[model samples]
Target: MELKSNWSKTGRISQNLLALTLLLLPLVFLLLVVLLPLWTMLQQTDPESYHMVWQDDFMRRQLGWTTIQAGISTFITLLLGVPVAWFITRIQFRGREWVLRLIMLPFVMPTLVAAMGILALFGAQGMLWRGWDDTPYLLLYGNVFFNLPVMVRAAYQGLCQVPANRLYAAQTLGANIWQRFVRVEWPQMRPWLSGAMCLVFIYCFSGFGLALLLGGERYGTLEVQIYQLIAYELDMAQAGVLVVWALSITLIAGLLYAVISKRTTFKATVQVLPPKTPSAGQKLGLALALVLLLLCCAMPILALGWRAISAGSSWQVLLEEDTWQALFNTIRFTVLAMALALLLGFCHAALAHRWAWVRSITFLPFMASPVCVSFGLLLCYPDYTASLSMLIATYALLAYPFITKDVLAAWDSLPVQYEQAARTLGAKNWQVLLFVTLPLLRPALQRGLALAAATCVGEFAATLFLSRPEWQTLTTLIYHYLGIAGQDNYDRAMVLTLILMLVAILIFSLLEWCTARKEKSLC
Candidate 1:
């Protein structure tokens, strides 16, 4: 019996090891394409050169301004985001669905394309620019534009999970609105507030495209410096240091955020929730919420659509065969990215179950500054003519954490007996996966893939590094137009920007419809 138990333990270890190895395969590909080159650059580059870049007064000032801008934007996004979240979740409102979607809009837009839209609205020569001050406040407006919605969604998700009975019971117990909110609502929402603030801070501080387009060489960060050193200065050492330095700062900040943000929940006194039904006041509040959603979403999108239509662009530029080809390229990248993300996500979920060690790695390129990761790839693959293989690899690296985390969450929610029952019924492993596992996981897989495709379509920072002129995708083209100062530059950028955003919205709408149909069928 002892010998049999020892064999069972070894068999279990072997099974877990197999899952871990499979899960790690994609990351290994990333190491070959992304991390290996990074290690080489760091080891080969001279340490002495970093001091030279640091010692320059102008460089130091630029660094200071960059840090200050990012910090300010982070704080502002949090301030604005928390209130919107609180209102949306706690207060009853109309058109809440529209508001939720609007908040997720910026999250889907590629940072560069979003930057173009923001530029058209608020840059030095932007439509809203009045020359009121020498420096435009792109840092603030741009930050709020992208970061606010993110905070809303995260915080709102947290708020929605709270028990409503607690608030109402507090009201019944002679507590005023202020007391009810302070004691019942605020205490429960502490987790989300901390997490959302930390997440928003991480995004703004490490943002690459907004900082680049808005800064106008006036500000430089560890992210921007990574690109400049490679493109302008050709200093691998400085570029390497910047990458390592940015990673360190972000890692430290993330660690601190996670530590501080974790909320301790005691497993006791479960609060029963009442049936949810909105009141007249809630209806009025919802109407106002819908108006706010329209204001936030409609203008920028309408601006882009108008530009695409009446920006004086030639029919050839608008409807040529190349335009069709470019659309194909975009779809191709989107599909491939989703596929890779799904595979990685599935593996991550499986391995995370069996091995605690597997949960430790977070090399999602999207989470970090895309410029840093892509440039690391750029140093190795200079001749990036076609994005087929190179871009797929990059997309997989970036989309991994998002797809994996969501899938893992959904998978863990399921019962283990489902798999075991199939296995006992004369089903081989592959057969079980095909018949039992895949179908059970279909909904989450669909949702994850939709998100991955949307994310890949808007990706530009890394593309900026890896894209060559010959086969440059739509996003890189949009970035090129935005960067060049000329007549109709903004106009043309707007044209492509509208196309990209529409593509994402259409895909998102389709997913929503599909999910709705699935729910209705079950009902």
Candidate 2:
């Protein structure tokens, strides 16, 4: 018994040391990679840069248009997303799960790939709008296509919390479907809708690839303009000014979203009836909405696939050595990024679990633009801009918040009884974590890793900002092909887009399958 007590004491010391190390490592990394760089950029920025941006008509217009476009996109998404959410949550239908999953495609797809797919479907040679010159329309379409799912998922989850008994009571009181929804359902869903709109607005506003590709010069967002300033104009001070402005806007929006999200709490468990079958009018409404959503979400992907197959000799591009090298580099970077993300996420989540204040540090990156982050890193370490290590670090840092969020959610969901039981059985803290806690967190870890990998695979802004010509990923290659004039180049870009989509889908599926298998084994 004395020996066991001594062993436990030693284990406690070792575990404390490990926890401290884990906590400090990520904090130091963020300081060096994220905070320090931004500080350096800020110090170097000319105060007059802000004045210049304010005085420039084009800059003011760009800021105005950015907010306008995001607002428009949010409105459109909510307009379309609410009905679909209601259908999925309140009404029964075949293939419902598949439809929900299909909407998630854009979430995993890289922005560059999504942009390319959109171009393929609406560009000069596009089937629907061949020879059209409507850049704003295209940009709006792309934003909606990508951001609609966020609203749909949030609204669906919120609507699911509505009690069936309340609805039944309303029905017995002669309240019609519309009346029940307006009186009982809308109140519960309002907070979620507001939060979702804020999130979608931020996403669309800060979007780099889609704004760059689809918005063109006439319709550039502040993010696109910042990238152009740094990459094309080499105007670091101006970029710094824009970064400050953009970060301020995003931070305010993020704070609003947090406040709204905090108020969206529901009961942990609610007794709800099974979804009701739709009446004929309801059925028709759902069918129409589903079809419209499919066209917006799936048609671009189908068009890309169709173009890849139909464009003869475009397949020959894959035979080139450079193409293969880019593909290999992409996979390598993605794997390394995902691994680093998982490690950092684990450390951050562990620390946050012990001390909730640590969670605030993880959100700092979300408020800053990726373009700004990459450019800040470049400014601080000019010599390492082209380095593979830099690329991996950029991807990992950008994805760290997402991984941390997932892991933290899963950690919070776990019951404390398991750890207590392990402790009662003479298990040390490290042993409890390694054997009891981590095993239970496998599903979340896998999900986080998969998401990080997919994000890295499609990451273009940071990659483009830091990568050298020799270190081009598939995304850069697609950018190159699209910049050149020719049907053949466009077709090749389409093919590469298809490849990226397939790769992302495969990773998502594999991780989900592994998580499912692990859960089944435990059961």
- The candidate scoring highest on lDDT is 2
TM-score versus the correct structure, for each prediction: 0.84, 0.93
State the C-alpha lDDT per candidate.
0.66, 0.83
372-425: candidate 2 lDDT, tens digit per residue = 889889888887877888888999997877788767767876878899999999
Scanning candidate 1 in windows of ten residues, the lowest lDDT window is 261-270
* Residue 443 local lDDT, model 1: 68
